[model samples]
Target chain A: MDVGELVDRAREGQPRAVARLISLVEDAHPRLREVAAALTPHTGRARVIGLTGPPGVGKSTSTSMLLSALRAEGKRVGVLAIDPSSPFSGGALLGDRIRMTEHATDPGVFIRSMATRGHLGGLSWATPQAVRVLDAAGFDVVLIETVGVGQSEVDVVKLADTTVVLLAPGLGDGIQAAKAGVLEIADVFVVNKADRDGAETVVRDLKQMIAYARREIRGESWRQPIVRTVAARGEGAQDLVKALSEHHDWLVSHGELERRRAERAADEVAAIALRELQARLTDLHGGGHLPAVAKKVVERELDPYAAADELLAALRAGRG
Target chain B: MDVGELVDRAREGQPRAVARLISLVEDAHPRLREVAAALTPHTGRARVIGLTGPPGVGKSTSTSMLLSALRAEGKRVGVLAIDPSSPFSGGALLGDRIRMTEHATDPGVFIRSMATRGHLGGLSWATPQAVRVLDAAGFDVVLIETVGVGQSEVDVVKLADTTVVLLAPGLGDGIQAAKAGVLEIADVFVVNKADRDGAETVVRDLKQMIAYARREIRGESWRQPIVRTVAARGEGAQDLVKALSEHHDWLVSHGELERRRAERAADEVAAIALRELQARLTDLHGGGHLPAVAKKVVERELDPYAAADELLAALRAGRG
Candidate 1:
């Protein structure tokens, strides 16, 4: 089938077609540009929500609960679970796969896992493309879920319209949430397992922290709301949804949504250009200016900074 | 004085001069090429070691003990502690500084903390330059310690001749160490706080894990050694040093040291060139091909991949 037909079928909510397009993106297939070109007209309609937190903070539970809530509202939801794919997970990863079984059979729910183990371009390159695929497939809401407190989670924040940072009591995650710089990114903070003894304290602490951040700021900005949730029991899922909707409303009203989407597109464009440049440099590793400069730097005839300049000059000069 | 004078004084072992040069690196000063050129001949002498693991694993304590052990051998040590600078760790960060006060007054020790906050270049960009500064300053050993298990820690692995992954008993760190992909990077595993009850179990688990890893391998490789240490009391500092020395020796014997250094230099060159290209793209964002392409992509007249290709083509065409 042609790229046009695939995109047409994907927009008709055909799961197989959507998955095929994403695989094309992931693999950087030769025809990826064609597929993306065909899908572009249908993109940028879905609301992208990012869910991130440290491990053992019940991120998955909260995500599952949120999915059910969205589905109940008659919204088609797509989930992209970003797994670090640790070889050490052994059997635990399988356990996580089982937790999502509730939504596995739902036609409205399209769930997929993207592993970071072997991707050279990294999560930043693949994620936005997959998000576009889901968005083009006509999903109303796309949930981007990532575990741990790391740089990749930070990248996810850029793609999301509303970011929910989940924390639990007794995990010391409140402080971690602050330390990992997650506090600055969260649009809504959810204290999952709110029935626990210290869950209230977690909520109080998050509010105070947000207050402190607000005081440090000069201009008008969204004040992140903290909500209490017992996600395992689905108690506060409604409140969580409400907060998300409010944030989304604020984003749209403030004209920030357009700015954020433009920034995301700019970043995507820059990353692809960078990767292409890197590939070109790698291709010139032997019998080229790159190796010559590298050899000089390695032999102490020139420093890396100087070598880099010489290499860049050569690359530019060759354009002649 | 000028950068040349700073280089001269830094090479003469002036602590302030060394500190200033590193600050220039961290700041990405415009004359960075000049400084790197001056320091090239003096680089490659220091024994670079990377210490990393999850938070609350007593990484700082272990680092202090290792410093003392290396100091006892009459070696000059320069430590570049990569602090995540989490706003939540206002108190704990101070505690870490206090822990290193024992060697603060020693002329043989130079400890500097590099905060990741507000630095757009990131740890990877600044770290190798700082290491070059320390290496040129006559330090016999340079210790690069970073907290948390993430992508930055993986970057730390590339800069080290030997990487020691520190873990503590009862922290569930053994499994975490595996999950974070630190298992593959470790040349030596130090189980800090060996006097604790679960210390023996941690050691046993690590050995069995390493054994399992070895069984799956088809080629000859360095077998990671696990050493137990009560770092707070400095009980096993001797053994830790022994393990590091043995790993260093193996790195030399197998010629992996040369390969690693070449790879590091190659990465540095690529990073600098990428930064240059990114700067050019940013310049083009306002009135050139980048913004033009971005607008078309945003409007769905062109896809991001196609737009990126156009931008690259424009860059290449301009080089002509």
Candidate 2:
């Protein structure tokens, strides 16, 4: 519970302290405010990268490969494997973390798996806070890996300085990626399993889509590069790393990094504000207001918008 | 847009009027409040059924078969095929709607495909409003079919009276469903493509999971029946319909139906209220308040929670 001592230990690169800080973020613990306040001054130094794809895309392998590549540069790396779909704290997804344990004894590598556990907004609300913990803990780079390309996953990736979308053949994921709106969010695309058949097709398809997307964009935009990787064998790791560095440079030069970080902060702040207002709304009339208004709305005595107006008025009156 | 007259026409079962009302909902039109007020009285009568599964599980086929079965019973049916992943309105997913055109001409059947078009909350916010339009249009049943088993899809299913989680052989979806927390939301299980090679295995796997889940429940829980169906061949349509009716009866007899509706209404009202608050927050300082607070947070001068507190105070001051 001594947040200052814990943060000091975390800043000294103590993995246990860093893990505890992130757990606080995940649990939405009451002392989270104190932890955030203690960690704020030391944050914003680490570079964040996000990796996401459909299931069976070898996301963990790609993440592990990236961790090794980043480590070769003598940079401390943090991995947050986020499973938005999993309700258990470490269910099924923790099994994927086993593949990552090759770095368990490495002092510079920290990996953690996060599941939603029925969180209000899934893991999006907690992800940035967890990233802040790692960033403040002095990791040179933080990699966020999400399980699926769902809306929540997209939201998580938006917090990254660079987003790498992985895809392979025979999953029909080339079009699936586009359909899920991954194409717009991807800063770099990795065609993993490059040794497999139809890898060329996935690359070609992504190339065409990226070209098409480029024409629609008005201002200066970084063209998303397609990197072919046989990640299981550690093939193409250097190229992927190089591509990531290039995208990071582009983000910085174009001022997109600052803009993205500020936008993420805004989103985080807004979500917290809404959660606070929601808590106050729930507390109104001893939590009876919602159910009462809901009953009236269900019974056709009121519409939802009017019901919302009444609730807002109650909120104002209570504030007064 | 003559919401009163439109509601009257919709009550008379005019499909055009119903379509217009739903279009207004989808557009988030300014007159949506008027439309909702007009439609409120006629809702609360229709049974809303939600069908969802992984892609290529024959969701469209199952929905088509169910539509046929429901129409054979002389019941008016409305279909809302929601593609939350699609960024374009009715893009790519409209192809699936073509297969349901046979029912398109049936005056008793109303079929519509809704794409999110980058809506703030995906299609979850618009779906209930669209369902209200159908309910007020004198539909006896409304079927909501979503593409994937993502978080947004789960949110959509929570609005349904009976939620059917479909799976097929060879998709490895039995475990995927459990991993995605779909097992907890599904009221019924459909092993579509029942004639396929691995159909029995899927049924057995689901049965085992269902039994495992049943043991975890403390109170009166519906034993989610695993129904086998070759939806593509129109087989098991009657069985599916029978199972739905049984679940409906169980819900009503247990008072769970009223409880679920009330919960859904409360969620709807809260979402509207949150959207209003979000708009007001955005309008503060001519939209510069958020970015300024966000910049401060990004610079680590203030933490996000404190930034949220500042925004909330500004909201109150502006209101006063």
Candidate 3:
């Protein structure tokens, strides 16, 4: 488990090495600290783009279309498909890796599906680390595709430099997008399934919502562009590509890119710090202290806040 | 603002005082410590029952019906409806409070809908506190209902003494339920809208799944009963109530009730302790330390793990 050798192989565009490093990240390997330090200097070159929408919106098709479009521009791309494991759908609707077989043998493309199940903090904890692996692996573009605009999906997209929210005709998605706070997080909006009957209505509704949002935001904010896409046929992928490029240019020119990356890094660092502290807390008093304190709280003999104080005090004392 | 006076009025069953106390908990007020301490002594008497299902399953109607049945038994019931603010549906489909107007004027029944939108840790952090408020207010039964079987909903039901997972015919919910791991968490299953077509199919599928699960889990496990009801017509409410009572008896007799409560309290205490530590971490170096560390990570001058270590070390030094 020589992290430097592994990282070196990953940087050389070895697919197996890249996959292994991400697996290490996903498993929270013991040498993760060493791996992170090894990969750090080679990272920060990939541009992250997030695509999200409700079910039945053709998110996977759109992602595959975008990947092809980016590859056509001679850019190496990495696709991280996040399956949030919907309680309603049971799992992701799109068999993304299967749909992406066209690029499977290409050295320039990397595709991985990460399921946010049984992972501590789920998406927020795991997605970024996997993204770091791809970024360090020298991918020019990292596209993160997630199903549904749940809270976790929104958090994942916030890590991207550009977030593209996809909607479609006849899913009642127009009102859902607005109500789900999708307008606030989306840098670019894609009306997928443009070949469908109500595509124009979805686009019009989105336009109105974007216009309303632009007026309310008091700053030099980028006006989100609405692009229509029949992604299944690859009809409007070039337009989506153009929209993404414009957003990325805007981010870099306005210094928003640096600020966003820094903020994302801060969040990542803070989350890791909290997790480390929690692990230590769990290890304290041979891991029996919390359960004992919780017993008293459950018995109504002690309050939760007081119990928390005792746990924190014990943690502090152990640190000494 | 006087914590003791508020707790006193709450225990006296004053609706306004109870509402005020829950609001304090939702807002995470400074006196929450005092409130928890005051409420601790009066807690642990109420039976906490959780009802959850996907949208369009009539969770609100079922909850209203259950409230009436409990009131008929001369029991004061409090309903804590958690709205998880789904990104797919936007908000809860059931205008629960509006639908529960039948019990609005009933002094013996109190209904509250807590939206988990901006609260830190969302449902996990706020629901328990609100439940404590209701329990301390001298309610004999507390019904916690949530729409959708997402992760947060599952976590919320884990706090209950008994969890009822509702499913409706023709929604393809049986497979979804099993896939979503609902079978493991549901202490009881209710097929609402049983008068609809495919009701028998749902019941049959659920029976098979439950039977399979029972075989897998050895020893004194309660077999989850499949209860059918057309909740809109108020049919089978008593049967559902009977099932709940039997489950409660099982829990009490088997000592599982205490075990569940102790586990729930431990989770609550751990969440609070982590939040307290996070607050302290945020308050360090005028809240600028994280941003500084994050900038270094973004510049590839430091890795995230190293940055987390730096943040932890700073917190430890600050504590000393």
> Over all chains combined, what TM-score does candidate 1 have?
0.92
User: Please, what is the TM-score per model?
Assistant: 0.92, 0.94, 0.95
lDDT of 2 at B112: 90
DockQ comparisons of all candidates to the true complex:
0.43, 0.48, 0.58
Docking class of 2: acceptable
* Candidate maximizing TM-score: 3
Candidate 3 per-residue lDDT, tens place, B129-183, comes to: 9999999999999999876535666678778999998888866434544553778
lDDT of 1 by residue, B110-210 (tens): 99988665454467778888999999999999999877545654575558889888777776545644643556778898888888888888888787778
Considering the two chains of model 1, state its CAPRI-style docking category. Answer: acceptable
Pick the winner on TM-score between candidates 1 and 2.
Answer: 2
Residue B156's lDDT in candidate 2: 84
Expressed as tens digits, the lDDT of each residue in A1-320 for candidate 2 is 79999999999999999999988888888898888899999999999999987767889999999999999999999999887562211344566778899999999999988766567655667899999999999999999998653567667877899989888887743554354366767889999999999999888877777777677752456788899998899999999999999999998999999999999899888877877787777786366998999999988899999998999888888888
Best by DockQ: 3
TM-score (chain A only) of candidate 1? 0.92
For model 3, what is the error of residue B267's alpha carbon versus the real structure, in angstroms, after optimal superposition?
0.5
Please identify model 3 stretches exceeding 4 Å from their true place: A85-87, A92-102, B91-97, B172-177
Q: Alpha carbon lDDT of residue A85, candidate 1? A: 37
Model 3 quality (TM-score): 0.95
